[model samples]
Target: MARIKNGILGGVQGCIGDVEGFIRNGEAFIRKRKKKSTVPRSVKQLANMQKMSVIGEMIHSMTSFVALGFELISKNQSFSANNAAKSYQLKHSLQGQYPNLNIDYAQVRLSEGQLPVAVNPIVNLMDNGVQFSWEIDADQSYDRATPRVMLLVYAPALKKSYYTLSGARKNAGTDFMELPDSFKGHELHAYISFITDDKNEISNSAYVGSIGPAFIEGRNEAEDSFKAQNDDHKDVLTTKSIEHKDLLIPAIITIDDIKPEKVVHTKPNDRFDKRAKAVMKRIKK
Candidate 1:
């Protein structure tokens, strides 16, 4: 009986040793596989790429949400919707291309008649010498290819007065009519109309009242100096306020001035001075 028990014990010990060895070998194999997997540069790059892609998707989602929110807010507020949406789309697209891009306010304020107030007017204004600009979020994410800017001008006096000056097509911000040379001496009333890229649009004509011919109010220094040097120069130095008679009147002819019964006086070239007609033609072409 004692000998049989000893043999059984030996068999059991052997089996336990075998099992321990198998476990050690399995652990080593697993460690080796893990090391091999991580050591390959390509594998590491692929992992990083996946991580970036995921981050980009997250960013895109977040930007899209924000853009939607902006649209809603714009609907309620006086903000430009088209510009806002364009900016949002631009940012998301850029983020997809480069994960770290960000967006912030990059708006350019433009008055009805004057140069755009923010940034360099020359660069911000369109090539046509018009005052037009876009309000953008300064996010590096905004697409460089498709900037958000659109403007329209409505002139009542021109034969064809409604013109769309879309920034997407061409730079037309600087294309405003040169203050008419004939208006150089007078205070002219100009009605300017505009709409932003975002459906946040408005078309009430802005009346720019009385822009005058360029003039200097101060006395002539040259004449004053000459007067100081000569006794007779006093007569020459007598400064008179030179009023430009042309500028004294309203730039646009009033309806009251037109005799209701009389045939409306139309110039042979009735459209010669019509800037709106010119703009409309250019847009159509």
Candidate 2:
């Protein structure tokens, strides 16, 4: 009986050990599966973060573009009118040298007291090539004797590089620059400086912006038409002046129906005839 009791206790102990081992194995398997599941979740979270970052960048870029467009359009009308007036004045001043000369002018207006000059949404093409136009208020009182205007253009792709020039004029602007054929897709920027005869000046060197590829649809047709008219005027001057010299030269000699020589002569063919003959002879010689 004692042996049988001992055998039963031992069997019970072995069964408990076997159950505990099975429980331990099951726990380990569950832990391994949990870890495996978490790896995919981690990868998914990382992917989501990357996508959000890309979206944020895109939104930022688009917002900048929209803002720039709005600013350009809003100030364009007034700026263009002002520039046209100034150009008219300049042309009027230069009329003696260039009788048939005129300027086809437009302006890119900025917001009241903006840093950079306003950029035209459309690209401007001139005789030289494509360029931009903007209005700049003179910083200091320009001297009538030696007024000075300064213009700066920045090439966006080449970093902060710029082109600068100085001249005499209170409200002078720029024509388009000749761009290389390979520079079709590049960007450009513009700034303004005004210097007075006293050497006092203002420089807004921080003014910076960007340009883009020229769109065929955005060409300034009105400006182009104005240029065409001016060109036609030039062509007329070149071609028609030789045939119409009488229209160009004023009549210096006026002839009256009554001959002055005949009426004023006291002695008919006396000294007057001799003087007239001598003058004629001198003229012929």
Candidate 3:
């Protein structure tokens, strides 16, 4: 609303259409309004929104660790660590179409820096916990040993993840992430990285292999579908209104819906085929 201070042609006091009015040094001034795009969102824009939604939700589950993981990378930047990592994941980690996107856990990175990454990383399921071990690089410097291992374990079905910002030292060669009793029967994905003791520097996270079943999300739903078809002759079928006994009416269909002639081909979903084969090799005894 722009109010005319004087009769008809004086100073404007508020906003009008694409401009705003203000009084500076007792002088009336108007500023042009910033324009907003009125066009419909493009296909790519919608796809990015879907990606952001999926990644944002997952990252929120482990925000504390994620924030610290990219702390240094986000230093002095406009965005926070969480957004930095999210931006990175949005570009490289997500897979599949708009509504059916999934995170490529193997390519997902928690931290980024110049420090050395975990080498020969291995994960194993044992005693209600997952063990993380890596071949430590032979850099005996204090900086190398000062870097501690950071670990993450994610349970997709549960949509919950647990991580250690600072766990075992890089030289420890092994670390264990104890899972709660609830994690026992679930499939898991693990990632590992290294951060300095002072949390100043970090290494790129490595995919520490997955254990348990390579369960496909949402596959647990009932494979077979049932559609009930029933027809009625309206209210005229009632005993009181049965004057049209000569008329043909549809019979109420009560069927089990299973066809004896129909055959369902159960395609093998064995660890997503050859991909799971390679992941299986990463499993250490």
Q: Which candidate should be chosen as best, given lDDT against the real structure?
A: 3
lDDT per residue for candidate 1 within 1-285, as digits (tens), equals 012223543222212321321122112111121224546456557655654454343234233223332444455454443445444434332332233443221221112222122222222222222343323334423322232233322222221122233434123333343322222223222223333445343232233332332222333567676545554432332111011112211332233433344433334355534643554464467
Give the TM-score comparing model 2 with the true structure, all chains together.
0.26
Q: Give one digit per residue, the lDDT tens place, for model 3 in 95-134.
A: 9997789899888888788888998999987755788999
lDDT of each: 0.32, 0.36, 0.74
> Which of the two, 1 or 2, has more lDDT?
2
Q: Between the candidate structures 1 and 3, which one is better when assessed by lDDT?
A: 3
What TM-score do all the candidates reach, one by one?
0.19, 0.26, 0.60
By summed lDDT, the worst window of 10 consecutive residues in model 2 runs over 25-34
Once fitted onto the true fold, the runs of candidate 1 whose alpha carbons sit more than 4 angstroms away are 1-129, 158-164, 168-285
C-alpha displacement of 1 in model 1, angstroms? 99
Best candidate according to TM-score: 3
Clashing residue pairs found in predicted model 2: none
